[model samples]
Target chain A: MYEFFHDPIYFLTMIGTVVFALSGAMAAARKELDIFGFIIVGLAPAVGGGTVRDLLLNAEKVFWIEDLNFLYVVIVVAVIAFFQVHRLEGKRYTLLMWADAFGLALFTIMGTQIAMTYDIHPVMVVVMGMITGTFGGMVRDIICNEVPFLLQKEIYALAAIVGSCAYLFFLHLGLDEQGAMVISVAATFIVRGLAIVFGWSLPPYKAGGSPT
Target chain B: MYEFFHDPIYFLTMIGTVVFALSGAMAAARKELDIFGFIIVGLAPAVGGGTVRDLLLNAEKVFWIEDLNFLYVVIVVAVIAFFQVHRLEGKRYTLLMWADAFGLALFTIMGTQIAMTYDIHPVMVVVMGMITGTFGGMVRDIICNEVPFLLQKEIYALAAIVGSCAYLFFLHLGLDEQGAMVISVAATFIVRGLAIVFGWSLPPYKAGGSPT
Candidate 1:
């Protein structure tokens, strides 16, 4: 019998769910949303990326629908985190960034692996990985009415691209799934972490002039 | 033989795709994005809503994947509209609103019918319809760094809800699919069009004391 936690994807996904859900909850709290809104905010970042990825892959079902446990995790995390978020407001931004980085790494690896399961162009697989990593946060930011961090001059998606490409590279080098996933996750986290700590960022794109 | 144009869904969907794609392309052009960026923007609104609905329904593939013509339509519309959009910049917002209203009406009826086919709860079917109608514009607005029109003090989603409920009501009144569809589509278009013309809007939510 394959237990849930024994599966690395499942375990990492659960961890990602909790952290991202908490981040969502915190954002909702800051927005002064009601409980229902907090739950929705939690759910968006928890499962939104995978949902988009599954659609692109033409998968039969989104992961959340396939496994109700993920939904449960989102609800549980939202409730728990919403109550405690006020106390942690001072450090929430920094904490949210780190948690988001972790979630990005995990989701990218899992999405890349799943896309690889179906034979497709290698470039698309890498894109699927990056999409999976960044879209959740993008969805959250959009709903929160903030500028989507991914579209800004952030190194966020670039980090995911690096990790996704590394995953493919390891697979090409004959590394097994678990070995490749570990290396790729670490690579993404380190790069993204250094980006945050060292204020690394891409140059902002400037439209030549305002719209005519 | 089920020829493409024989299906009203196909025809309306194509129209919706083209208009929405043009809207997206015009937005990107105004932003001074490169050709590749314009195409991405075009594709976002062209299929974003249906892609989202398909994901929620756990469909085997998104509608676009089932038909490549949709992708072709997006590309063609993007290119053509990109060149001509500047000429109509004076009336672009009004034209975009009308096109969006038409697309919303068409997509809502079709999406509601499809969700009803899946035998989900009737309310969820209506909700699915509204989701399908408005999400594409929301995605487009988000990508363009504007607040999502759906989330603004706009009657956008409410218009979808009205059409979706009308679809369900007509279905309940023993109107067949074809009958209910046409009526529901007209109802949505009328309501959305009137809202735009009358400048109907909801009161913006105040976050208490105006940003502290």
Candidate 2:
């Protein structure tokens, strides 16, 4: 077995990259951006989270920089999606949400696992996971000048946090790495999916009784 | 002089941190965010850019995490500005703009100086400098759900890039580290200040005549 369970994790990371890139491309299309705009925005979420995770952990090298495949996949996916997104008609938002859900799930587990190598506090690990999962989309929203999905009442970062905790819990229960990852991804995906279909959200923060 | 010319750079970095935090806090005040919101938003612009730069370069330790002073300064400034911003009254926007200009100038030079140690291509060094100068405000604007000042029709990132190039140019011309830094900061501040006062901006990117 590889130390980081290299094969499966790497495969899922690529999938997450592709999905997030597609979401970004679709966002660009919605905003009526030019081709260069599509590529820039698409690339942001695709690599943003992982780049941040690697930075915070001081990884030996940033992952995409070390492996060109992630970059190629995102570029190809973005270009393809930029043209194809218009055909989705009204289904674009739905597709983007689902794509983001999977990206969130995969990245949350990947980030948690990477941070695990550093032997930091468990809370920090979870926060890293959430950062990895949410930052990409938050950046995408920022570029498009929309309120970030994470900062809104959406049940987004909470899902990543819960999934990160589940991964730790499963690992403690003696599950193998692959099993823990699988369960963790499913847990995050389900929570986020439910929120999308049902509109579940945290209450908006209301400032208390007029500041002194 | 110290290897990185530690004393002057360190003092300027702190000054940059305080100014950026004040800008963020003022933004929160404009948005009427709660005290917690003020701190969180304020902290983002204060540390966000350097954090991104450190991560990209794989710094041994993130600066703030290694030195608590930067973090403490941001928090204190954020809290103080949360209450004091209201008193700035009609001057708040002007104050925020000027503070941001100083932060941009300081951070651009600081980031360029740090990246110089890595021996990367000069272009990458300049890019890093721009990222360091602009990302904080971009993030603050993102959190507040406004179009990022960097992304819009503003002379923001251009100023950082110009300063980064000037730093490189001066150093290449055999100027000492301190001289290079001083000139670079002044160049950036003048360019950005002119934009703020005279409304200079890059024209909006227009998609070519209805894509085929």
Candidate 3:
């Protein structure tokens, strides 16, 4: 169980980190930020979740503090994105959107796995998953001085919740860790992708203009 | 011990919530947001810390959910600020800045206490304090399309850290809870206010251009 859980978690986290970093860099490019801004955005989205998680869990050190590779990955991605901005112009948004969705899904599953390792309850694990998946981007948006996507646009966080629920259900059904992760990530991606494609949104509250 | 902790915690939290709500509404008034935006900003800063804590702790329900008074306080403050914006403009920035500093101090101490209640380590508690104190303002700034003071300014988060350290040290000295709380909040406020007054700041990293 340890071997199965550990290796897959590491791989998924690496992939999610890279994808988030690239998407963050893409956002910085669109915002016309300089090299330093791009690097900060990229690094925040890549490592912000783990930083939050480690803090909450009272883990020994932050993920990036423990491993410089995460920082290097974000730096490399930001640099690449910065130089290739023109090539990415037309497809930038779409590419970043998809990458963000993928990262979200992967991080959600990975977060749940880590929470379980700590013996936290399933419901708590689900919440952690949502935090891990969405918070980095939320932080990124805040840093960029934009309304976080979670607050305004598509059902991004709701998708993470749905995936967490699916993961819990699969675990209840006695699926192996690998199988449950696959199902969870796939569910998150599907929900998020569909929302993006369909422009789905939660109903906005229609508060009257001014109440006398 | 439980009884000793209960009432003081509740009182401190109430004070923190009210001040943060007022500060947030004051910020919104400066930005000329309508009633709705004002209310949202007020509520976000007031309830944001407890909400984040509960989510991370996997508590049964968010603190605001358990006590609707938190929402009521924010709404009332927002409403008052909206109507009183004209008068507030006389000392708008000054009032808001002081209120923000007070809110930061109060919330940071409260958050650290809560984390300690959950048996988290001191380091993690300090981190949580910093998050609780500053993240709300970060959210408010983002919604207002401004750079977060934490990233732009040097001493903002550092003040919270100093207060957290002070709180821990007092606790180590076996001071009563109220003593620790007062000392911590006073320490944070003093540091932040001095920074504002004296233009004390950590040296900015040597960089060619503005980060933004």
Clash pairs for candidate 3 = none
Q: By DockQ thresholds, what CAPRI class is model 2?
A: incorrect
Tens-place lDDT digits, model 1, residues A162-187: 99999999989999878988999999
Query: Per-residue lDDT for A18-50 in model 2, tens only?
Result: 999988887776666655456567878998887
lDDT of 2: 0.82
Interface RMSD of each: 5.9, 5.2, 8.6
> TM-score of every model?
0.61, 0.62, 0.61
Global CA lDDT computed for model 3: 0.76
Error of 3 at B129 (Å): 10
Q: What tens-digit string does per-residue lDDT give for candidate 1 at B1-60?
A: 112245666787799888888878877765665444455578888888888898888776
Report, in order, each candidate's fnat. Answer: 0.16, 0.25, 0.09
DockQ of every candidate: 0.14, 0.15, 0.11
Give each prediction's root-mean-square deviation over alpha carbons.
7.6, 7.4, 8.6
lDDT tens digits, residue span B34-71, model 3 = 56556667877787766676667665555554355676
TM-score, predicted candidate 1 vs. hidden true structure? 0.61
Tens-digit lDDT track of model 2 for B1-212: 11444776778888999999898888788799988898899888888998878778777777778778877998899888876777888877887788889999999888888887775767778867887898888788878887666665567777888999999999999999889989999999999999999998754433332234
Model 3 sits at a Cα RMSD from the real structure of 8.6
- On the 0 to 100 scale, the lDDT of residue B3 in model 2 is 49
- Positional deviation of A87 in candidate 3, in angstroms? 1.5
